[model samples]
Target: MAVATAALGLAAVLPGPASADPGSEVRISRTAYGVPHILARDFDGLGRGYGYAFAQDNVCELADQVVTQRGERSRWFGPDGNDGEGVNLASDAYYTGQRRAGTVERLLAREAPLGPTPELRRMVQGYADGYNRYLRETGVAHLPDPRCKGKPWARPITALDLWSVIHDVNRVSGTRQLVPEIGDARPPGTDTATSVSRVPGPARSADFGSNGWALGRDATRGGNAMVLANPHLPWADGALRFYQVHLTIPGTLDVSGAGLYGTPLVLIGHNKDVAWTHTASDAEHGSMYALELAAGDPTSYVVDGRTERMGRRTVPVTVRGADGRLTTVERTLYTSRFGPVLSTGWTTKTAYTYRDANADNLRSMNTWLAMGRASNLDELRTAQDTSQGNPWTYTLAADTSGDTYFTDASAVPHLTDAQLERCTLPGGPAEPDALDGSTSACAWGSDPDALVPGLYGPSHQPELTRADYVANSNNGPRYTNRDAPLTGFPGTYDTGDRLGLRAELGLRMIAERRDGSDGLGAPGFTAGTLRATMFGNRVLSAETGRDDLVALCRAHPVLEATDGRATDVRRACAVLARWDTRADTDSRGAALWGTYYDHLMESRSPDETGQGRALADAVRDFAAEGLPVDTKLGTLQKWAGVPLPGCDGGKGCFNVLEASPESGTGTPTAGAFGSSFLMAVELTPDGPRARTLLTYGQSANPASPHYADQTRLFSRKRWVTERFTAAEIAADPHLEVKTLRG
Candidate 1:
């Protein structure tokens, strides 16, 4: 492991914020659940404390992200290591290709207001230094966590490494998933072109999900603004996992909530005057370009009848083999004027390429910083409009002045509907997603209001401000509020009127709670009611489908599965008949419903042909696992020995918990991804009051006391009372303090 260059010493210091140079000193105060409250003089110092505390709980994951962004995964882990979507060799090639092309460096070199600001650059530098300082102090071999302790991959990182990872995260929904197709793309006669594993279509909406609601005075019980941020993300230890923190720079900036590991900003949090959260948006941030090849020349594409040779580059990636020997492999990767060439089953006559709007985007940190410092909804809107840095998420925010805001201000292409229609290739393989590359005019449209030329201006995108509320459950920006639907936006912005079941459920919950008709004793939402609404575990599908299912079960007591198995489902039917539809931990029949739904969907038949049989098979599968059909949801859906409540959002549960199936059975064994960092913030007379929870807990290390503490709380439908005020933080019984100096 390489020795860290930064020198930081940890010792006991005074409790107040520092006024010295940012790199000189900072203080980190840890409250219950290991949530860090960092105090510093400025942005750099805030990042320093943030980086140190983050490293204390998640050094291994941080190191892993740095390695991944540096295109060194194959070099350290292996060439065959799977990066969830593709093989490590391919992932390395894609990242290395971008590096060799000097893509990130060029973006970074851009002057401020478009690229990273000086403050953001300082924050990033301090974050890297603080991460390296922790490494230097702990000595990589003696690191506390066993995952990367004494591992060769646990090397200190630089600010550039952090920037690279930021670039990768900003493209989560874009070309990041096309690594295999990009890396394996070769000319028709090349040996690698035919073997490219075809990535199915555009990225699935399931890749990211969340429910964000900003409730204004009209909808809140106390006539104040309230916000509920429930992001559904993978629970695995990686870049997607959220880390809770409270960053303060005295009067300059103070915000609390959670950000993905390795980020320097409080991505979803609130200060005294404003609170904001994000939901995954389905707007197109990247687009496919179907290239027409020149006659008899696969490497040359025809643009408006002119032959243009594809730009070629050779990327060499280092791979560590089974014998611990390092070898370099060189791959010739091709690119077009649009972007990287992709091998999505392209023929000799035509090929595909993709352009990601966020490939060189480096403004998210600045945008988030501006939001944190914003005093009201107007300022927050200004932040989004000016920075244009939100990669692919809708921002939902509230202010003390009783205003609510929602916008899908993601970095979408500025292409107009007419251009999309005209540029769409006839019989294109990835239609609606792919455009004709034969004409240069089919390229991205320009908007004067856009910070970048190829993106839609803020005015052209959809946004809404309503006094009642604005809510999004991974839906388009049209129906943020039922009464005040935002329309007249370009089709590229996902202005569809139809809503998914999960999104429908989100709106229903907000409306029900607002009208006080959902039976929780509320005409308007309070912080407590907001919490209840989140974990109510209402299974919308069961509520809408269960009675009919019960009638069907009674009609067919005996059913035969397509697999030739038969079962008497009368007992299961009886249990479900009297069962509640909620997916609470103790709710019986929820597990049965989950399995039934999975099997029923897998059968692909909506009628009684395989539907009844699917139910029978679900029962049989449960019994085979020695579990009853009426087993509790928590009993089946668990992780790290903690019983997680809630069924899959696909099954229409507002409190989403998507789980994976047991081996060879439809029965769900453990949660896969959904409902990660959750927070309910209310702006009151005395600043903002909030309750938050990181469902998977703070530290990924099993030995850490905080590893499963919050997960247990989440299982019990509990939340950690957010200690935002200085006095509140000092009053915590489990509070621990540490100060670092350089």
Candidate 2:
């Protein structure tokens, strides 16, 4: 791959409208497992091929997302009244406010020095054109999926729609939660603002997160870098859908990995010389401000001792009636100097406003694009430092030079310690309502004219590099590496003092191997070692807490019997006593222990002592649900629509699998959110060798063969070989070729 110093200038030569014919220059070849290998002459052609391939697999999903982003869901498919369209009146109101805010238009116009650059602009345009072309070629009657074949929302999409989707993604984590408050600011009988008194804590939910690992030469058997990218995202919804593709612009770009729908760049993946992944970071990306409302007018607030009226905008929201007619309802939205004015419904005298780090950011794609083009770990770091577009994810990268890096690349609010101390109210800064906004002291101190104000410059963020290894399981930057701990960073960035079980497990795995006389007697990792560790079903809780639980059970074996529940409890103890600490499909005793552990964590009983009450409850619940005490873990925890044996372990386990309870049995064992996309890349002397598996398969269309192919493979702990090079792609016997054009 050739390194271009002025890589951003490559977009300047992108074919003009007359010469930029998609079908003439873009060739998409479907390799094994339905992965598209796109060969394009330039960035525009690459985008065209990407849009066509994505539409082929997820047209309906894409269409639905477009509809949601356009804020016309209610107009097209009635209010979210249990119609299965997944859009509600609140959604309509929120999206309408977003559109009326001019988020897309403003960002596009301002993104320049830090940019959705010319290259990105051309690529997005080409992608929109290609998506439209797909819709034109495959009429509604010929649509692949019958579920949304004739739906009016599945019509052609525009470039603006794509831009809006991107904007929505950036704001989803920040202001999306205030939709109801924005819609119901001045409800009848409510004259006060809502109280945002509760402070945000470290997210402990098992619903969404990721585990990323990078191994340098010192920790690897081949003296090469290795990376494991396991992002735990939703399996079904289009929200976190990750589409895999290999894009090549000859000498300009050659990168392959997974990205979400509607994005034109690969968010996580590897190029020839560098491989990278991301995990949610514990950084504050937004701030809440308490405004002192002026007397006699609720919508006017005092700033710098001057009464400033909040800007008011009425968004017309259209909702479809039961009879299919549309009715337009007007929703009043107010914005203060701080940002959107949220109706907190608090009786207190103060109003609240929220400002997000990426509120007007449109340069995230450009950053990812630059990272993809990087030739080394240093280059990747430079790309991140230059384009601070990443909103809230820590980046982990490994290069062929045997270097490993980890950084809180998320754009965080640059708040100084003095500012926080001076402006903090009685409550701590963690409390949403703690910031005193009457004066500019509590304000995010950034130049008002800057494109994205209050964001930390690259020098302010925390980063670490280790020749041995680096890993993060969504914990703060302080524990990126246990031995070489990142210290002295401000507490305002991350206040969590302890590491989660998953992070502990990841560190332990690396430390044990590094200390032991392993492969080549140097704690070196091989491809096989990494793969085994990822699939290893050892549950951390079982390993650490099982012996004590069994001892406690043996001591107080007898509980009050209710419908033979006492006998079931003894049986569960016996099963757990003889169980091996593993979460594989056929592991016995896993189900009982998993249930017991879950209840132990969730039990709110004040009368029960220690784990006894939780254990008894787990036994009683298991018996009541008609499941045997010694049921195999696989039988109780199955994936959707699959009859195969289930895997064990909950969130924080090395083999992480968090799930909801099965309807029939009250055991929380069914798979919900886990590692949907797993990619392991190893940098070699020849090039980069990769393997990946998507647990839910590639396409959302049920009729497609690729829909469940990888899911079956995932069930058996298997991975499909990632063909990166031209020769490797050509060697796939099942390859199918197509040429898409204008």
Candidate 3:
């Protein structure tokens, strides 16, 4: 996606900046977790350090992405193949389209007036180079392909390879750009509905969402700014690029945060002066305009007020053939103004108009890089005004001023609710049938309001409660309790369930102030407050008397439990009490139950159930059916699908979140996906730094000795500090060093 020149020739992709000196070096050390504490002399060196370190374990993923960028997936895996080959095929198609995408590329190329600064770009490139160096060092030898069953590796990677990888990253970033083509399988009674509401789907779709929050003392009265980032994502298929690093540019900046592969800087976390976070807007940023196919044929459609050819794009995907060699697959891509029109709808004569923030060419990363250097409130807002990245969400930042601002900064096409409704399959009265998968379907309403999606009408900006503090990663500003109801823009849009828990309880904690003061009525209530306020409500519900388990527990006060397990009795109870027993976290009960509304302290109604389902309920159910109140967590809660849960053929338990563990009664738990990556910051007159919680240990390699090693600490709410200073990084005896030349 990185254009090479005015001619718009796509740059041949490259690896991390190649080392100018063959002897130039970088070093990495393993800390408490497998998280690498990298040390390098220059920005490029640092990148190489991280790259080599990451590649040691996840080279396969890295290489796959590299293939994806060049649209070479089909070449390696073969075309028409759905498994490994399909991805390559798809990637190839997208890349091929990009090569043909003059207009699209031009639009994507628009610099967001600003983006990552030159210095930060160097840093990003530095990391990429570091990764390439790893390829050079280790990929020189053939490695086993667990998926393909071959010695898959690199003889030597070039910068072109890295560029190819970025090419894939760009494609992944725009996966939502294509629209599904509606075909002849139209179902009955489908047109009467108003707006798109779970019309029959094509089966499954992508799973991705994130949660981030910033809490201040007015909210916590704690002397620091706390940022929690939980990006909920499916684990496999190159879905996440998680890296936790503490970047110290000396006086320029200092921050402890999480980064993705390919990205140079942290996505969310706290710097010296402030902390910022984000969450998806869940707005129908992408809409579909029904196509009136010529003579009811599914393939032909109208564009620009005239019947036009729907450019046919065929993707050849490679997969493992029954005979073993990779095979080819050919898939079709048709276009409308929105982008590529897909075939998804059943028998409905329509094509969708694809749109999303991905279309925004503004410097999303550049804006963030500037964000890292922002010192005060005004500068922060200015940095944000660029509206570079994902437009369908908002980013919130808070500084020492106890000041916070929320902005929907993205170049969004102006499409009204009326316009959006028209596009819905079950669209309302005014459903407009403009079938071309192009921009004409959903026209930009305006630019001023387009770039900024959220409403800043009258009232007050969502701030750290004067009496409290609040922040979110696309978790809306509903948590900051102003006098108004939790209605900022006035509609229910849930990007993910975690945001629900965060917003609902975040407000409750802020509003539950016993004192007339603006903040929570406690002296130093951060650590315990989190345990009591957030974790407490979900685990310990007021519900009672549904079964005799409560009465039995009343008889036995303490349950002998192991420490450190988030699912242990104490931990389990705390988490359970705060969460509503509902699967849809956006439900009012989700907020109320977690908030301990009128009934949090009160006993449960006879018919009401407790917070968690499986272990707590199962054990309590057993007790009600003649078991002891003193049941053990290990004995009841078990790894349901662990393939093999028993060590010596005995059962052990595992916790589920976001969604339920079992098939029936699919209610989710807060423990599911709340805090995958959490870091707490302390930036006072004393300056800034952080403490972190990364759930599974850092490295992706399961075989490495350091793998999963940090899980023990993270599970216990413990953190290992990041040593950013050169001296500190070098001082560790665990250091392993290597060098690479460009």
Q: Write the per-residue lDDT of candidate 3 for residues 667-720, one digit (tens) a residue.
A: 222213333455555555555555565544455555555444554443333555
Identify the candidate with maximal TM-score.
1
Could you estimate the TM-score for every candidate? 0.94, 0.90, 0.68
Q: Order candidates by TM-score, high to low.
A: 1, 2, 3
Better of 1 and 2 by lDDT: 1
Position 468, candidate 1: lDDT:
91
lDDT of 2 by residue, 326-377 (tens): 8887767778888776655322356667777777777788789999999998
In each prediction, how many residue pairs overlap at the backbone (N, C-alpha, C within less than 3 A)?
A: 0, 9, 91
| Clash pairs for candidate 2 | 23-740, 23-741, 23-742, 193-345, 193-346, 194-344, 194-345, 194-346, 634-646
Query: lDDT tens string, model 1, 412-438?
Result: 898899998888765434333568898
TM-score of model number 3: 0.68
Off by over 4 Å in 2: 1-23, 81-87, 187-207, 346-348, 421-434, 447-451, 516-522, 560-568, 604-608, 643-651, 665-671
Whole-model lDDT for model 1 versus the true structure? 0.84
Flag regions of model 1 displaced more than 4 Å. 1-23, 83-86, 193-195, 204-206, 426-433, 563-566, 624-626, 664-671
